[model samples]
Target: MSVWAAVLALIIERVWGYPDRVYRILSHPVVWMGWVIGKGDETFNKPDETSFETGRLVGAVCLGAFLALVLVVTQPVARLFSALPGGWVFEAAVASSFLAQKSLGEAVARVAAALREGPIEAAREAVSHIVGRDTAGLDEAEISRAAIETLAENASDGVVAPLFYLVLFGLPGIAVYKAINTADSMIGHTSDRYRAFGWAAAKLDDVANFIPARLTALLIALAARWIPGAVPGGALRTARRDSIRHASPNAGWPEAALAGALGFGLGGPRAYKGEVLDLPAMGDGRRELDADDIDRALTLYRRLLDVLLGATVACAVVVWVV
Candidate 1:
C-alpha cells in the first residue's frame, strides 16, 4: 500500500506539480470548516467549569466529525477534479495541493520581504503565521531568528510529514494528519482549560510525527554540506546532540538539525500569550540570526524538498519494478 501510494504521488508530482488556484479553493473549504467548528469553542468558552467541560465535549465531537467529513469529501472532489480538461493539469493541481514546497517558500519569503519593507515589527507580523511565539517588541535578530526557526520547523511539519503520509496512505492519510495537527494547534497546550482534555490530541500528533521528524532531520543534515560555510560533520553531530533538548520530543529534531546546519542557534526563551516560557536552545552556535540566515535556511529547505521528491520517485520506481 505504501509503495503504491508513493508511486502515484510521484507521478502526480512529476507530471502535475502544485497550482496556486487549487490551493486557494481547497483553503476555502478547509479553513471554513475549521472556523465553523472552532467558533463553537470561542462562543462557548468561559471561565466557569461547566462551560469548560461543555466546550471540550463540543470540540472533540466537532473534530471527529470534521475528520470524517474530509475523508468522505476528498475522494469525490479529487475524482471530479481529475475529470477536468487537462489530465496533467488536474494531476499537477492535486499533487501541488498535497505538496507544501511552494507554500512554505512563499510563507518564509513574505517574512523576508516584510522585513525588507519595514523592520523587525513587519517581519514579526509576517512570521506569526509560521510560528507560535509572541512577536511584539522583537529586535531584528529576534525576528530573523523566529523566521528561520519557523522555516526549519515547517519544512518538516508542513512539507515532509504530509508527503510521508501521502506516500504511505494517500489523500485520506494526509487529510487525517492535517486534521489532527490542526486540532492540536487549536487546543493542545498546557493551559488551565486544555491540560487534560487536549492531552490526547497532543500525544496523538506526537506519535504520528515521530518518524517523519527524524527523517526530515536526516535529510536536512545531508543537504547542509551544500550550504557555504557549513561544517557537515559538525552539523550532523550537533543535530544528534541537540534535537532532544526542545520542549516537543518531535519538533526538536528537524529544528535542531536546521539550526546546526545553518550555523546558528534557535529555540530560545520567548513569550507566549503574556507568559514567559524558558525554552531550550537547539544548537551550540552563537545567537547571530539575521536576514541572511533566513535566506540560507530557505536555500536548505529547497534542497531538502528536492531530495525528498527524488527519493520518493526512486522508491516508487523500485516498488513498481519489483
Candidate 2:
C-alpha cells in the first residue's frame, strides 16, 4: 500500500505539479517548516552572543523538537489514512506535494527558454531564482553553468532524497527527512551567523543525503548513456575522482556526475553575499557552457526522473506481490 501510494504521488505530481492556486491557498509544507526554523533561529541562534558550543546545543535542541513535531503529525495522519477507504490516495497526494521533480524541470527549462529567446539579463533573472550564488555579474556562460549546477544539486536534495526516504520508511520517513532538509536550507551555511547554529541541521542533512546522493550520481551516469554527446563511462570515472572536490559531502556527487555527463567544467569558485568561495572544479571538460548545454542538462535530468519513476513502479509491484 505504501508503494502504491508512492506511485500515485509521483503520477499526481507529474501531471499537476502543485498548482499555483493550491500553493496560494495552502502555502506549502516546506514553507511551514521554514517558518518554524526561522522562529527557532530568531529565538536561539543569536550570532553575536551565542558561543559555538551553545549554538550547537541550541541547534540540536531545535532539530530534535522539529523532528518530534513531524513524527507526531505524520504518524497519526498515516494511521488515519490506513483507516479510511482508498485513503492511501490522499496520502499519495500529501507525499507528492513534498517532491519537486516537475517543478524543478520547469524552473530549469525557464532558464534555457529565457536564454534562447531573451537577453542575458532575462536568463540571469530566471537562473537567480534557483541558485544562491551571486548572479548580478554573470555572463551567458556563467548563467548557464549556474542553472545546470543548481539543477543537478537539487535533483538529489529536492527529489531523490525525499523519494529514498519514502521507499525506506514510508510517510513518516519522508516527513522527517524534509524537515531536516528544510532546516539545512534555511540556516545551513558557513557565515558567522549560521556557522555554529546551523551545524546540527547541516550535519544531519549530510547524513540523510549521503546514500541518496551517491545513488543519484550513479543514476545520472546511467542517464548519460541515453543523452547524445554524453559519455556514461566518463561520467562514472569523473564522479569517482572528483565528487569529493566540492565543499559539500553530498552535493558534489550529483554535480560532478552532471558535469561529466555534459562534458563540461562546473563547481569552480563563485561569490555569495559578496564573498568569493574558492571551490574546485568538478570536471576537466570544457568551461564554455551555453544555452544549448543547459538544454542538454535538462534532458539528462528529465531522463533521470523517468528512471527514478520506473524504479519506483518496480519496487511497488514487488511489494504488492510479495
Candidate 3:
C-alpha cells in the first residue's frame, strides 16, 4: 500500500503540481517547516553573544527538536490514513506535495521561454527564481548552464530523494527528509551568522542525500539511452570522473551526468556574493551553451521523469505480486 502511495503520488504530481490556491489558503508544508526553522534561529542564535562552539552545539539540539516535531506531526496522520478506506489517495496527495517534478520542470522551462521571447533580463529573472548564483551578469551560455544544472540537482533532491524516503518508510520518511532538507536550505550557509549554527543541518542533509544523489545519476544515465544526442556512456564516465571534483559530495553526480549526457560544460567559475568559485568543469564539451541547449536538457529531463515513474510503477507491481 505504501508502495502504491509512492506511485500514485508521482502520477498526481505529474498531472497537477501543487496548486497556487491551496498554497495561498494553507501555505505549504515546507513553508511551515521554514517558519519553525526561523523561530529556532531567532531564539537560539544570538549571533553577537554566542560563541562558535556553543552555536554548533545549539544547532544540533535544534535539529533534533525539529525532526522530533516532524515525526510527531506526521505519524498520527499516517496512522489515520492507514485506517481509512481509500486512504492511500489522501496519502498520495500529501506525498505529492513533497515532490517537485511538475514545478521544477515548469520553472526551468520558463527560463528557456524567457530567453526565446524576451530580453536577457527576463531570462535572468526567471533563472533567479530557481538558482542561488548571481544571475545579473550572466550571458546566454551561463543562463543555459544554470537552468540545466538546476534541473539536474533539483531532480535529485526535490524529486528522487523524497520519493526514495516515501517508498522506504512511507509518509513519515518523506516528512522527516523534507524537514531536514528544508532546515538546511534555510540555515545552512557559509555566512558568519549561520556557519556554526547550521553545521548540523548541513551535514545531516549531505548524509540523507548521499544515496539518492547517486541513484539520480544512474537514472539519468539510463534515461540518456533513449534521448537522441544524449550519451549514456558519457554520463557514467563523466559522473565517475568529474563528480568527485565538486565541492558538494552529492550535487556533482547528477550535474556531471547531465553535463555528460548533453555534452555541455558545467560548474566553472561561478560567483557568489562577489567571491569567485572556480569549481572544476564537468564534461568535455562545448562551453557556449544556448537556448537550444536548454531545450535539449528539458527534453532529457522530461524523459528522465517518465523513466522514474515507470520504474516506480514496476516496483509497485513487483510488491503487489510478492
User: Highest lDDT, which number?
Assistant: 3
Error of 2 at 142 (Å): 0.5
Candidate 3 per-residue lDDT, tens place, 115-182, comes to 99989999999999999989999998999999999999999999999999999999999999999999
Q: What lDDT does model 1 reach?
A: 0.72
Report RMSD (Å) for each prediction in the order shown: 3.7, 1.1, 0.9
Q: In candidate 2, what are the lDDT values of residues 270-291, reduced to their tens digit?
A: 9998989899998998888888
**Clash count in backbone of candidate 1:** 2
> Would you estimate the TM-scores of all the predictions?
0.83, 0.97, 0.98
| Model 3: worst 10 consecutive residues (lDDT sum) | 270-279
What's the alpha carbon RMSD for model 3? 0.9
Report lDDT (Cα) of residue 34, candidate 2: 91
Residue pairs with colliding backbones in model 3 are none
Candidates ranked, most accurate by TM-score first: 3, 2, 1
